[model samples]
Target: MTTLLAASQTAALLPYPALAREIAALLADALVRVPARLVQALPGGASLFVMPAFDARLAIAKLITFTPANAGSGRPAIQGDVLVFDVASGARRLQLDGPTVTARRTAAVSLLAAQRLAPGNAGPLLVVGAGAQGRAHLEAFAQGLGIREVRIASRSAASASALAAHARTLGLQASVADDPERQLADCPLAVTCTPAAGVVLRGRLRDDAFVAAVGAFTPAMVELAPQLCRDVAARGTIVVDTPDAQHEAGDLLQAGLDVARLPDLRAVVLGPARPSPGPVLFKSCGWAGWDLAAARCAVDQLEQS
Candidate 1:
């Protein structure tokens, strides 16, 4: 019989950064991307996705669901399940909770993107949300970058402040952004962790700025301003895990960014190591392989424990 695990169980077993680094390495090895297949529902909203990938080593399949309304109920906004199987015999290996995997993978990808795109030892990082995912991003990036400064920006300054205070306990110099966009002038790197339907990085920022946006997967939602996309197009390369998905993502869509024109992840060297040409932008459209890869890491941890 296949063993079933819960999100809480997975949480207790896995360390966020370890899972993130493992996933990042897997992705760097030419693992396929899983573009989320979305389905819009009634009064509020939800989405369903089937993520599948295979190589000579292993095969993974997962089903993920997203319900924004669940947040008020103190439940995760996104949740899912994993069905790991043997590639040679198609025998089921194990079943694990999906939510923990999603959050970790999302954060891990954000960290990997930051490492590849943001300037080294770049101080004064601005995180644009204070929810679970936002906190995860802050933690993973701090571990990966040894971040010197971090500022949390949210619709509620109070919540942002609270989150910043929490980070301080983790040995990070964090605080809330009194004026998020204003911080952009001084902060070299900015990360948008919200699901806002409109732009959050407003006003002017220096030309040599790196922005990593992991919000608003749909074509109707956006966190980065359209002007920033235009700026990156002019001065730096806009890196996307999948350009086709970005075409559907709201930030680029609302900006009227030509999806056909933007460069894909394959086009850029996430590096063996190099300095960015200018201010690079990395956009994520919520892929399934990321979740699967992170899940694999969590499962390994559980087995060891």
Candidate 2:
């Protein structure tokens, strides 16, 4: 019988640590096949995304909608579902919540990259957005990396405070930052999760700092200042989560950086030597392979249960 998992149920199955492990394994093996996803334009400045991926054991497709206008409308900008199928029998095995998978997998990818590229995994993360992605990154880093403190920064004070409170509930020392740029210098690890048309974070960062820039997936959106990208590239290393980032990573593209020359997360994962010296910047653009890994994780957990 086919099973459908709700958002909460899906979350329970794909824990950060396990999901990170699966992502690492996927990267190392490089067996999963993910073709370019199709994006269809909708009437009201919205888009529909059809992403598909497959491996020997399982095949999955994620259908989701992206509506930028939903911001502040008490509705999510992205929503959808992931359909998982058995490869050998061509039978539907499970259905996973799309947004939940996107959130967890994206954060898991960051955690994996941080483990491989970050100067250090120790505490005090600075998160630039207080929405779902911010919350997911907070929990992923705190639980996966043993981070004990966090600083929240967002355009909305209420949202920032709420995320801080949520962090406190997780037994972490949390506070809202009035100026995220000022906090950047002190934060050793950070993740930017905002959806901004312009730069939302920029400043001098500590030499050992590591940042996962997950916001602004399209070329037209940007979160980090152009100078920041140039600075990181000059001082340290800038790694992309996937090669698709070359086309979709607005932060790097807007910075006038040649993303094609940057090393991808897979290289960092498979390399025997650590990333080059200095701070590291990891740019993530959503990929179907990530969702495939999430599906594998969920199915494995379900079988064990």
* Candidate achieving the largest TM-score: 2
Write down the TM-score for model 2: 0.98
Which residue pairs show backbone clashes in model 1? 219-250
lDDT of 2 at 144: 93
Give the alpha carbon lDDT tens digit for every residue of 196-302 in model 1.
65688865555666777888777778887888777777776677766556556677777777766666554554445444577777787776666567656755775
Candidates in order: C-alpha RMSD to true structure: 2.8, 0.8
TM-scores, each model vs. reference? 0.86, 0.98
Best by lDDT: 2
Which lDDT value does model 2 have at 167?
A: 96
lDDT of 2 by residue, 262-299 (tens): 99988888888887789899999989999999999999
Candidate 1 stretches with Cα past 4 Å from truth are: 12-17, 28-44, 71-73, 269-276, 299-305
